[model samples]
Target chain A: MDQRPPDHITAAPSLAAKPPIVTLDGVSKAYANGTVALRDVNLSIGRAQFVSLLGPSGCGKSTLLRLIAGLGDLTGGRIDWPGSAKASDGTPKRDLGFVFQEPTLMPWANVFDNVYLPLKLGRLSRKQARPRIMDALAMVGLEKFERSYPRELSGGMKMRVSIARALITRPSVLLMDEPFAALDEITRFRLNDDLLRLWAGRDWTVIFVTHSVYESVYLSNRIVVMGARPGRITADLAIDAPYPRSEAFRMIPAYNEYCRMVSAELHATMGEASPE
Target chain B: MSTSAEPVAQRADRRLIALRIALPILVGVVFLGTWQILVTWLQVPKFVLPAPSLIATAFVDDFASLMGSLWFTLTVTVEAFILAVVGGVALAVLFSQSEIVATALFPYAVILQVTPVVSIAPLIIIWVGYDNVRVALLILAWIVAFFPVLSNTTLGLRSTDHNLRNLMQLYGASRWRILTEVQFPSALPYLLAGMKISGGLSLIGAVVAEFVAGSGASTGLAWRIIEAGNRLDIPRMFAALALLSVLGIAIFGVLSAFEYLMLRHWHESAVRREN
Candidate 1:
């Protein structure tokens, strides 16, 4: 339990200390059926920052994450990856990892092979990629389950494998879409702690999507609360909680205050969408 | 008490295994015995329904020539099965790559599947020439066997987990890598299922084609059965039929074993669940 607040929040002279790694300018997504999923969204993600897109379902939090990952074609506006633009051939820069809402493990493959997937796609031989694959499985604390298939694992373990696979590429940015939303509370808490530790150990940025106010407050250095009915960002609040935030931090008054603030902003957005 | 219970459980397991083998064998023995006794008591003519004993003696008496014909049929069935698998999988992969190609070609594949091979066997025989009748039979059998592979594999390829596809896209995975590592492995159970159905269908196609061809000395087990029928050698016909049934069972057994071996560790259908 490292009781230190995130170094980026407390240590920086200004909030904009680091240059933006990714910039989403006036982004909008409207399906062909005339449903507006997102509208005029503007956000900048700084290097190594843990940002949570916190909102109710249909607030396009997941959609926003997908747009950042280049999974979907944005209906409007531009997404710029300043560092990744150097290798520009118009393909979304391959320097980002995405973890879906589901564990999404290839049910046919074992943990080792699943984690080795990105490397295999890159044409790295098994002999060349073995160490990195083992390292990733070890990072997720699944080294002993290397040969175990996804079907044999518990829900928490599967999500851990998904995280390991996502981290294997060692991307500059990691985009997660409500990962661990399916897990039980105890498992979720354990994962939240583990995620923070991993964040502290690395220099990569994380853009996490979640509907849980407590989760957003606990994990993120910055929480961007979103609203539905033509999805848009309703509030941008910083959780100045120190890391490594442990089980003890969850009991503190400041943690409750941050949760309340996020919850109030979300309630305000939801109320605005439906008058009744 | 716990130690005593362990051996009791082990004994039960051993008995279950024994029953699994013994039950089917016992039923088969009872069936043969009843048929033999009934036929002998009634003084039934062999032409109508040969007794199990007569069929067995016929099987031994004509063993050499019957085996030669069995070998011929097996070769054709095996060849047709191989071609069906290869062609079906190749086409499925092609379909997976291009929607336009699939749309253009898939209906024709369905048409081929629906049309009876027996009706087309004569045309194939004519086109391929009497000397290459085996090739004609092979083509007809392939037609019967290839569709399940194509349709099932295409479904499997298309049904790849969307999240996994998105993850692959996030990594900028090449088309080939995605196909081999993701789509192909996902399609394994479906492909094996198609193979099993096609295995049986291929045998039927070969036999049907041989029946239609009616080439006397040069043909397969089906031709032997046809010749025996013309001669009213019902016992020999029953013997040939028995051989064909055995071949079908053997084909099914081999395919099932393969499916189990491939999917035992991961697939839901193959892995045993305690609950």
Candidate 2:
């Protein structure tokens, strides 16, 4: 093997450290109404894996994602990262990107401005961020819609703008909460394919929340099936599907079998009654 | 030709617009003809119910004096409306900054609005000591006319999109930037609607105040009505009343057109064709 470069080349240890993107130790969340949403969820996601929190409604899947996104604090556990200490004592490090179910685009902003919001928030000059914004919009296939307002776009197009906005930050971890549930079946399938394409290309981790068994099976490398009535993780399944998954894959028996299994698990999860 | 189909649709639309205009004029003619016939048959006194022809003749005879007072009333209305927009929008922005201050001063604004300017004009006349009290009376009318706009605009400012509001917060937008960019733009339709209502109200207020505050020179239409009544010039009084009604319709029409143009693309109220 060739020896490494000289001292100058090896100097100032790389600040590009690949720390664990998410570390939740015994994270429990109880709402103000005394309803425990999540109980002692111990999870670790690696740097660039696409993981899905698959569950029915009221399964604390969104709660878990919000915890990871630093949107809300855990009631009885700790979430830690390298820069967690310097974030003003209790303020979590604002690093994760989140996409909500409703596109939630600013109604007054055009597509380009919406995509540039986070970067502008990060104090980058508009000229400095313009190229990156355009590139992100192009990645979402909304390059021509840069001047169009949110109300003028279709539902699917608005969600694409949202995804573009999320990706413009180039964050390490992306959190989504049922982003495609409101979309039609066809648009949902298209977006699922596009998301997988983006996931395959970028060196970024994702934690997607969805109630759709088919969606969970299709986009994720690993699926965490959660049950309600105090919201616990019941099954964790690894999808051994290959990359660059196409619409043609859905017609295959293997894909059908996986969808059937996840659907059955989801049905079972929703059918579970509370324990006395 | 395809152009033939387009001109056919255009002709249909033009006919539709013409019918729209013709129908209203037809309705007005029918109403006046009925009124003239009924009153002539009923033999009503001329002082109580002058015929449309008599009123028209009186209007033509006294056209010069009537036009002068009409101009005076219009000038006061325009001046008062400008003052209200400037003062009201400023006060609204100031109140939006501090809730405690808004809550404290809002009752005073309500009192100022509801209290009749007619009763107050005499006192103002004594204080200002002249017919220049017309300006003060116009100011008083304008205050009432604009506060609803101030309050409505303030509410609209506070009722911004929550997620977008959060986005602004995360972006560290200053209070003024948020006000000008997000809050003000969102509140525009509401403010304009309030302005539409308030524009007519300001004109009414101007005439009403002029009735009480006019001295010798700048007598508005309201004062002319009073002068006609004192002289038993019943048809002339009706003519002044007609001019006032025309003034009101003109003010409201101008405001509605402005509202339509301003919000045509964005707001539902102003959008013409929806798919």
Instruction: Give candidate 2's error at residue B153 in angstroms.
Output: 2.2
Residue-level lDDT tens digits of model 1 in B7-87: 987798899899999999999999999999999999999999889999999999999989999999999999999999999
Local accuracy by lDDT, each model: 0.88, 0.79
A237 Cα displacement, candidate 1 (Å): 0.8
Model 2 off-target regions past 4 Å?
A1-18, A25-42, A63-97, A106-134, A144-152, A226-240, A251-276, B1-9, B29-46, B51-54, B57-64, B86-132, B170-172, B212-218
How close to the true structure is residue B159 of candidate 2, measured as C-alpha lDDT?
A: 80
Clashes of each: 3, 0
lDDT of 1 by residue, A1-276 (tens): 232333333422233357888888999999999999999998887887899999989999888998888889999999988767554666545587888889999888889888888888878898999999898888879999999999989999999999998888888898999998999999999999988988896888999999999998899988888999799998777777778899999899888766766677788888843221
iRMS of every model, one decimal?
A: 0.9, 2.8
* Residue A16 lDDT, candidate 2, scale 0-100: 19
How many angstroms is residue A194 displaced in model 2 relative to the true structure, after the best TM-score fit?
1.6
Pull out the clashing pairs in model 2.
Answer: none
In lDDT terms, how accurate is model 2?
A: 0.79
Please list all clashing residue pairs in model 1, or write none if there are none: A4-A243, A5-A242, A5-A243
lDDT of 2 by residue, B88-207 (tens): 778888888888989999888888888887887678667866747676767766865887688778778888776566546544467887787677878887788888878887887887
List the candidates' TM-scores in order.
Answer: 0.94, 0.80
